[model samples]
Target: MSLPTTTKEYFWKELGSLANLSFRESKLPPLKSHEVLVKIHAVSLQYRDLVIGLGQYPANVRDQLVACSDMAGEVILAGKDAGSEWKPGDRVSANFCADHIAGETTLEIQQTAHGGPIHGVLTQYKSFRPHSLVRIPEHLSYEEASTLPCAALTAYNALMGPVPVKSGDTVLILGTGGVSIHGLQFALASGAKVIVTSSSDEKLKIATKLGAQHVINYNKTPEWQEKILEITGGRGVDHILDVVGALDQTLKAIRIGGWIHTIGFLNGTAADVSLGNLMKVCYIRGVNIGSVAQFKDMNRLLASHPEVTRPVVDKVFAFEETLQAYNYLQSQAHVGKVVIKVV
Candidate 1:
């Protein structure tokens, strides 16, 4: 049994944007049988959090829903069956799926994403389960580790799953956003050729510095997918990280039997139909943010990958400047992850 040291706890609450989030004091819930009291060190921003705050992301879990996904923290109080890997002082990262503890990511387990259907992490002290908290890799600071639970892990599942990519495989990464950035590292470290595209040549240049062998400024060539086919000598890419979303341009972008991870809708949500092009080019698979089991699996592979020296942080904002970070993300000016520092 644990006792509270303070009568009130600080949490962020926003019923809507007109009333911007404010700090509220609340009492802690009783700890569950397999939960730990975690003192959160950092909270990560996500598109879904902004959507939820704007009343765009709907959830049955009404009001008082905290608004952040990824977090890093230390265990404070451990439950009886919380197990051996976690202790009072262990530094850890929480998975987006608070319920998917480990092993295979079955469909049921994969459905529990944070900051929407479940309570979010924008608080100082949160009750975490052993299933949700994974120990941090030794090389990363809490801030760096905090960004991986969703984006990096999703890219991992897209590239490093049961399928093995070899020295000469080709991957086409669309855009310079978080998913594409992580995808670039995975492709480079796995000995695959990477072709990265961006609307800005300047951003493409930066991605090239990050090990992209070929860069296409889509702004320069509107028929950029044709440029892709030309660069690959009409063979087309073996894999395409189509974070481009519902765009039919990506449908024309891959070789037959090649795989495409349909992760986000950054380009456009509703694009023209091209069933023939999609069938002729390749296969498409939708990706969610991924699971804790997947996170551990990917971490083991990534710990050894030379290309992933660190998550490329375009900028870091102070904890209080989280809204600014969100606005910057809205601007789409960065080539990689924009982080917030919380302590």
Candidate 2:
């Protein structure tokens, strides 16, 4: 089947802030060599998108950015060198960190497809390099697969890389948000005892159901780190997945020679990160979303771990309800990934 050369493409445009976001149709761009055209099937809403739309992403892109990063779609056109690996009808997901296909951090490749650096995937159809995507797992629906490219991949990288997790390690995750939830699953699958902390006792209950070995209501137990020590018989946790960079709660919670991976500062970024905290760290690393290659490896790992699924997909909205999805995610009342079905 031949690809549609052009079509009336629908996309959400950013005129200014989140207040100015509107859905509109415009001419679609033609597919270029090494570029594959995908018909977007689902777009998941993320807080970072809200921050980008509101002009708060740490390195905000040029204004009027498309304003979303995670999306799953089907390939309709493959570039000349793209090979037959992905042709029309393949279900695949795009990696938000498009250029970091191999190796560790390099400023050059990191700039290319990061949501802040270029046009993102908020549109109905998007063009990406054939090398920049991974096939959705066979058992997952588009929306479920859509959850991985950004949030899940980062969680996988932060938990698994630079040092592979081993059995019996204590993994502490803050918040019951998407990344933390996903990190919780991966940690459990790795045979580690997972501890989740949240202000909501209700959410902590849900976390326990999802394989969290322990839960801390950060509200009542403001000294949750003490709870971690108590839970582990005062050994302290070996690794912490810090999605909320709330001050140095994560730093204080970790044991001496422990690692903390920062994926977000939802808790607050301004808090002090003392040298004393670092004095004992095995590694306090910052994870950007992972590369296309790492994404594929993660998929392989995910396929084996049935426990690793999208934790709390609270609602699904129609394609035209993209705005509603964004608003719902911003509300933060939802437990899991809030997704929009885009045909």
Candidate 3:
């Protein structure tokens, strides 16, 4: 028996630019037996949000769809059969792929991603299946927890998945963006040395403070791969988190028998790599975020080691200023996650 009836939400009215987003108020749907109504407190922005806003994502680009995947909220109401685990006042966050509870990912599960193809949590309130929501760490505020689902989970999966990173191995992170920053934190937690690259000396200095053992200025050293080889004594890095999709540089920078996780395309979408380069690495795995089970695993790790895994939020915006947040993201001035606080 909840008293709140109407909710305010942002919708992507057309497939074009950020200007197409529309705001409106709607009546909250009747909660299903297995549903929990969440009062969204904060949402985080991702690069994909920009692509989705620009109508560039390959799938699930629908008119009037909600436009964000990461959010943290409190459970305001729960249906009779919602489950014993949930109650009013419980803080939670939604998984990136709502249907991926456990096991390997499938096309069906991938298609159910929030934001682009599905209605997202960019609203004041949203109804979610209990299985799709997980409890947030008690030590983290709603804003901090909102940065996890996509960026943090992707980094965690890259480090802890099939090819697990280990102590003493060196990891090369491409930039100072959300995913890379999270990767740097996880790599440090795994007891691995980190090498982060950026065009800015300032961001590199920040990365150094965040525990990166070495920072390279890619703009200053256009042939940054050569510098990586020089730094590693020609052995190259043990793992390369290829956020830039810079295949040529990645090929040159990864040591033989190392792993490379392809996570983003900030530099370019297409590239040619030598067959010789392919033979040297363990594998080049393409990382989408992760499953709900993986999300839980990440949360467990975060709870145990809060110091090593705090999300770096660059700026906070009011809920009405989502467009400004998007513009800020487009400017690429932020070093970490951009967040929106929804009161």
Candidate 4:
């Protein structure tokens, strides 16, 4: 195949609103020795992407930067040193942290995170170091695979990280967004009993169908932590995916020595932490997605359970409707991932 000379991409021409996003054609440079050029098929929206676009993310973003992080694509060209394992037509997803292949992520690794500090994958074609990409599961479509880089992997790491959720453990998932739903799926597949909370009873019904053992309407039951205790025979849950940043409530709902994976800040970032509540002896750990090695491990599990582990895509927008996709994500009406079909 002949290499293309130019590509179309969406960039944050200026920040503060989705309207600031501009689409333009630009030169597609030749790949370096260790680089692979991917034809992006789809990109998934995350809350952080919206935050960054609004100039609210606490990071140094470049001017006129390309938009999002999570993408699924076909490797259309690979430079000679890009590794023999990658080739044209390989379906792949880029890791959010380009250089954090394994082990603990450092400040340097975080700097390379896509969408904010660096140019992301919201282009028709993008170049990447081969090490930054992972072969996606064969059973997943480009839309489903696109959701894995951030949401699915964050859920996987929250459940299967330092302290893994095992069969028979009880887990509490906070909402019905992409990460929460993925956490529900992962926990259920691990044989853990899952309790999901949402403000909408309608979304709660959907969570029930998705295999949650119990559901809580937080709007109806503001002190849902007490209900969690009642559901768990007064013992509290073994793991809590604290997406809402409600530390006080999580501290109340956690079991003795339980794990609380602080994954999101939907409510707000500032939360009053009580040292007295710390006496519950629960472990509070913040999740920063996962490494390339962890992503490969998650894909193996997804491959093994192809029938059950598909990502739930709420809606898909065309390449030209990228702004609409961002607006829809901002609206937060979608239960799962909102995708952009770039191909």
- Give the top-scoring candidate (lDDT): 4
Ranking by lDDT: 4, 3, 2, 1
lDDT of 4 by residue, 148-249 (tens): 999999999999988899999999999999999899999988989999999999889989988898999999999999999999998999999988888878
Question: Lowest summed-lDDT stretch of 10 residues in model 2?
Answer: 7-16
With a 3 Å backbone cut-off (N, CA, C), the pairs that clash in candidate 4 are none
Q: Find the 10 residues in a row with the least total lDDT in model 1.
A: 3-12
C-alpha lDDT score of every prediction, in listed order: 0.74, 0.78, 0.89, 0.91
Estimate candidate 4's RMSD in Å. Answer: 1.1
Clash pairs, candidate 3, are none
> After superposing candidate 1, which stretches have Cα over 4 Å from the reference?
1-19, 58-61, 102-111, 267-281, 306-309
For 1-343, candidate 1 gives per-residue lDDT tens digits of: 4655432222236555614655555677877878888877776666656566666554544466666788777788888888777778888888888877655667566456666666667666788778888887777777777778877887887887556556899898988887789888888888899999888988988998898999988878889889988988987788888777735676677787777778854455665556667566466777776667788877776678734547787888776777787778777898778777764
lDDT of 2 by residue, 128-182 (tens): 8877788988877888887888788889889888877778899998888788888
Q: Estimate TM-scores for all models.
A: 0.89, 0.92, 0.97, 0.98
lDDT of 3: 0.89
Error of 3 at 86 (Å): 0.9
Shift in Å, residue 287, candidate 3: 0.4
Clashing pairs in 1: none
As a whole number from 0 to 100, the lDDT of residue 214 in candidate 1 is 95
Q: Candidate 3, 276: how far from true, in Å?
A: 3.3
| Candidate 3 structure quality by residue, lDDT tens digits, 1-343 | 5357889988888877889878889898877888999999999999998988887776666567987999999999888998888999999999998998997889888878899667888999999999999888999989999999999999998888787888998999999999999999989988999999999999999999989999999989999999999989999888888888887778878899888899966667555577877767557888989988999999888888898889999999998898999999999999989999997
